[model samples]
Target: MEQREGYKRELYKHWNKGLDAGDGCDTRREVIISEAIKAPVVTAGCKLTGGSWLSPYDGVTVSDAGKLDVDHMVPLAEVHDSGGYAWDAGRREAYANDQGSPSTLIAVTAKSNRSKSDKDPAQWLPPAADYRCTYAAEWTGTKLRWELAADEAERQALLALAGECPTTTVVYGTAP
Candidate 1:
């Protein structure tokens, strides 16, 4: 209750910081993926209720947990390299486990997740072209929330991917 809220508030205060005083710059995809698979948060529907597994990567539906991976929209490695080396472990863990936030912790296919392993937008992309716009918004939103900076190549790639989808003003909520 209050204790949880307090911790959340504290973490949010230093939300921009990540593991190992920012040295935890690598996406740590293996560790993150392994942990997420152990305890997955259900996906939400358009209205926010728990919905069936819908992978934005390939626009496929899968009910089997083994088939999914909880993707970090703004990859851990990218953040670590960008500035995560300065953050505390708690902040990094929260960012790693962020799920209540919209489009932050998506359940995508294992193949897609593996394909996206530790790479920024410049290195990987969704197979479903239509989702690129939403994906960019989600990625940008996470980075903005964590006060993270994107590499020049990643920025360019995101922009290019976003261009193919319908335009919408991107907005991110306060840190939880």
Candidate 2:
């Protein structure tokens, strides 16, 4: 696949409160709520307080919502660099806030999520060694679901990681 040029995170709009109309929660909060180990106490306006979350990336358990981040499995800039630069604004928005599949967006510790910002498997992996297999599968599944292109190095890294996770399976449908 030909790589796109001039990729920018601004190309995709994210964290829209209205993405899921009438849900009252923005994309970030929704992810946190769904992934919470114990459901948080939500206010009438969808403000979340006091929740416990398990960060799959680092194997850390966090009870503070402030420490969690909603990570796009395929980061926005990576998506734009892959094929999203050509997508219409609505499609970009959908990709940014995609919650159709549990793998699309995830809740991780803010530290791990930032460390992974826009980097593919070729450049970054979870700090927790045991999570590598699941991470690779999720990464591949996200790329496949979004029809995103992976560079040769990224593909090879994913394949190698898959070898370590012989039983891990990826099941996904097309992106919106």
Candidate 3:
């Protein structure tokens, strides 16, 4: 496959330029708020101080929102390599800030998010064994949502994972 020339993280304007919801919080904060198992207090500057969250990627419960990372299910670089290179700047930005789908942006432990990095199902699976099926399904669904294509290795990995978890289903909607 021919790799695209440009895939700098800057191409996709992540978290947006300013406050996205008129509140002080940005996209990342919004995701944190939505995913928190226990609602955290929003302070004067939209600082999230306390929250209990379950990082599905590692099955770790986190008490500090600061310890959580809002991860793109299909990490940005993987999205670029998976055909997002063809997307226009606006679409790229939208993809980066997408919150319409719960599966697209997940809140997980910082460690888990960093470890997974920009890897696809072919390269990485969640450390939590129970999340493997869901992760694969969400990864496939996110690719489909953005009209992105998966390479052969990723396809095979997802297929093999599907074979292992026959009951897991992928449900997705086209991104606007």
How big is the positional error of residue 65 in model 3, measured in Å on the Cα after superposition?
Answer: 0.7
Model 1 lDDT per residue over 79-136, tens place: 6765655668776677766654655566678888888877888888788987877878
What candidate 2 gets wrong by more than 4 Å, as runs, is 2-4, 18-20
> Please, what is the TM-score per model?
0.67, 0.94, 0.95
Choose 1 or 3, whichever is better by lDDT.
3
After TM-score superposition, the amount by which residue 38's alpha carbon in candidate 3 deviates from its true location, in angstroms, is: 0.6
Best by TM-score: 3
Cα distance off (Å), candidate 3, residue 118 = 0.8
Model 2 per-residue lDDT tens digits across residues 19-87: 566879888888899899988999987888987999999999999998899999888888888888889
**Which of the numbered candidates is closest to the native, going by highest lDDT?**
3
After superposition on all C-alphas, the RMSD of every candidate to the true structure, in Å, is: 11.7, 1.4, 1.6
User: lDDT by residue for model 3 over 57-108, one digit each (tens)?
Assistant: 9999999998989899998888888788888999998999889888988999
Q: Could you tell me which 10 consecutive residues in candidate 3 have the lowest summed lDDT?
A: 15-24
All candidates in order of lDDT, best leading = 3, 2, 1
Higher-TM-score candidate among 1 and 2? 2
